[model samples]
Target: MESTQTVPINQKKTDKYPKSVPYIIGNEAAERFSFYGMRSILPTFLVAQFFNPSSNPAMQTMAEAQANEQTHFFVALAYAMPLVGGILADWFFGKYKVILYISLLYCIGHLTLAIYDHDLQGFTFGLVLIAIGAGCIKSCVSANVGDQFDESNQHLMSKVYGWFYFSINAGSVFATLMIPIIYAKYGSAWAFGVPGILMALATFIFWLGRRKYRKVPPSGIQRNNFLFISLYALANVGKKKKGESWLDVAKANFKEESVEGVKAVYRVLMVFAFIPIFWAMWDQNLSEWVLQAAKMDRTVFGIELLPEQVQTVNPMFLLSLIPVFTYIIYPFFDKLGLKTTPLRRIGTGLFLTACSFVIIALIQEQIDNGGSPTIWWQILAYFLLSAAEVLVSITGLEYAYTHSPKAMKSTMSAIWLLTVAVGNIFVSLVNSSIANKGFFAQLEGATYFWFFVGLMMAFLLVFMLVSGRIKERSFIVNEAEA
Candidate 1:
């Protein structure tokens, strides 16, 4: 095994992929399977196995809505916890230790769900642990993928990231299809326990690669960390001299580089402010869309499909669409004199996302009009949604990474993930509110979907205006170029 000090920040670039790459990618595939598998059935499990036990239709409807709200809250917490995980890894333990230790807790979360299927208190506790565990490691794991490469293999990093994303979708597609069937055929215990076992396997696979990894050590408590810089800037903003912004005041006590980095993050965050709404609409494919499927004719070509199982369409489309866009669509567009820029992709995605919701709202109107439309309507909606995902999500992460300052690279990843938390929380708030009361009470039935459509279109305008004005800032470059 290499010492903590063995790996340097700059090393010779190699054309060959690192041997550890396989282990890391493999770990991600399995880990994604575990994570998505558990969540795929979670909303249904909550509504059916626990919350909706009462026979009254009113009670059942309330239970269903509450289950959906709880599901979003769970997602919100899971994404929100990345801050804690990032802080611990950066300031105390390295990524490897934090991931492993927290993953053990993650396994316990699944076990709790499997063992206490009907107990709300235990179930809630289990979810909290899982959310924390998932959030804590999400950023670290993604960062670890790049840590394995240097200049020699730098070109291969993009390809590796592509494969990394491929593995994620592959794992999700399989889990989404399988887990619900397991629950319906056998029971919740097997459904939940299967993913738990996979998580254990993922941990073991990660551990097995210990000797081959180029382990990046933690940077002990530093004044340059995002929190420290932000706090210092806020505390001293009033002392700013002429020709200075609020953050510039911190330059008295902090390095100019650190202040610049903090300011860059703030600038990037302005663009990010509109992104949570994307997640708010996109994540509904898991909760609201699934519930919608329950009211549809889920049979196609003589085969019956479970409502929970329908979400497999999104990832399934993702597997095919990502490659299609990279090799065919992108090249074709380039030849036509329109290079596929990240912001362009994001803007296009925002529009398509709103279009997809319009489809969903239309379908809901059909259902409300006492029509049992084919599952293909939702499947069609997933295609547009999945395409939007390939455009927005994949491009957005790369955008976040490239734009961050070197000092705040990992911190930016966590902040990007925090957007998803914000999105889910927004959904939870809207779902838990509106309903039979509140300002948006009129936003019932298909009107709910239409509201999100308006939200997406409004942000699309903001993003186009903002993204056009900002220049790309690459932290992965030389100081002068940066």
Candidate 2:
């Protein structure tokens, strides 16, 4: 049990951070290294398993397309499971416990990948385990980071989450740079095995901080969570109290605060609805972008870069840009009489994403014309994409935490992650659709890139118009900072 000295974040009395903060940061770095290390090589490994790259040109094309589809499918499934993870942590096991326990399962998943390096069935089974294990802890980790402080240190929450994201990219940078080299030199088993070791180390680092942690115990097996109470309100609809709201019907069976919280979540979900379009463009970095790199001239300054190595710059850019945005760009914009509000920042990011895809589409056009574009073109695209990600992903995470009901932050974080799944599902569907013979099935290369560019621009226009309708409210966390 955590010390009785631990209190809910909303009730904290000090501006200083709790001891658990560094441990969370450390664990995140190691865990990201492990996750990305494995993921960075997943596409290459899948393609090798399914078909030889040295095969017929048409066969290679089909193989690459299928590999991209399966990769996104795995990504979608991994992200989708966070809802279940959120429910578990919010209603059964506490965040700390759930994270620790599932982390062990995550290690097992990595080990399975290493052991069954050449077996498709076993490798897929490992992906399922890893997806669930990774997905389950994702909500708990993000929410648990917030739960460490109350209003006393709420202002620091933003800085901490910044660091949280930094650690993620830090690890990703290391893995993306190193793992591909490992895969090239040592082959599949060692490439996957190395990440498994990092995961175990991540687990140990988390466990070491257990005693000093400010743990939030779960709301144990009660019929009082968001789902149950929302259903209760629906059943009791039209039986409302005279002066109360529609949701107040559930006040007979539950608390008024709980019902209002759900309403707030619903409103936030409206803003969230348009975000999948942004993600559809952003996550293509791993799928479509990597494949695009393979066809480009990797030589820059006489040093030939590996296709995967080109993406390492993304994390590197993020590392520098996050601080630049926080300390320079945003402050400069604010001084110039422009309010860099979260919604506005997100809108700018969406526009930038569309711009990046324009560059990508142009590159695809070159590739289709049998020209190998310089890797520098793709690098420039990644810069725009990275900047866009800093705004959309980081700002969105902080928004999800601060704007939603305090009671279900884990669930809210899970909801945010589910948007990624939704976006990837769209990509996967499009990927599979191309495999069939249809009008659009003939669409590949630059044509495919233009399709997403148009899609994103349409969504960006919609998001800009609708996001203004979202009524954002600040909670105890970071209230003073605003």
Q: Estimate each model's TM-score.
A: 0.90, 0.87
Using TM-score, give the best candidate's number. 1
Local distance difference test, per candidate? 0.86, 0.84
Of candidate 1, the 10-residue stretch with the lowest lDDT total is 3-12
**Candidate 1 CA-lDDT value:** 0.86
Alpha-carbon runs more than 4 Å astray in model 1 = 1-19, 149-160, 331-340, 434-438, 464-468, 471-482
Write the residue-wise lDDT of candidate 2 on 1-482 in tens digits.
Answer: 57354456567656787789999999999999999999888876777765454666676556666777777888888899888887788678888888999999999999999999888789888888888888888877877888887756777798998899789888998999899899989998999999999999999999999997888888776565678888888888879878776777877887777777777777778878878888877888987788789899999899988777888888888878899999999999999999899889888998999999999999999999999999999999999999999999989888777787677665677789999999988887787777554445766779888999999888888887888778888664544454
Q: Cα RMSD (Å) between model 2 and the true structure?
A: 4.7
Query: Looking at candidate 2, what is the lDDT of residue 129?
Result: 84
User: Candidate 1 lDDT, tens digit per residue, 1-482?
Assistant: 57343334676545789889988988889989999999999887887877776546566555666777789999999999988887888779988899889989988998998888878999889889889888899878887888888756777898998899788988898899999999999999899999998888888888899988888899888876778778988888789888888898887788998888888888778767878998999999998899889889999789999998999988778888998999999899999999888788988988989999999999999988989889998999999999999988888787887777777777777888899999999988886775335666567678889999998988998788888887677766755454
Distance from true position, residue 392, model 1, in Å? 1.7
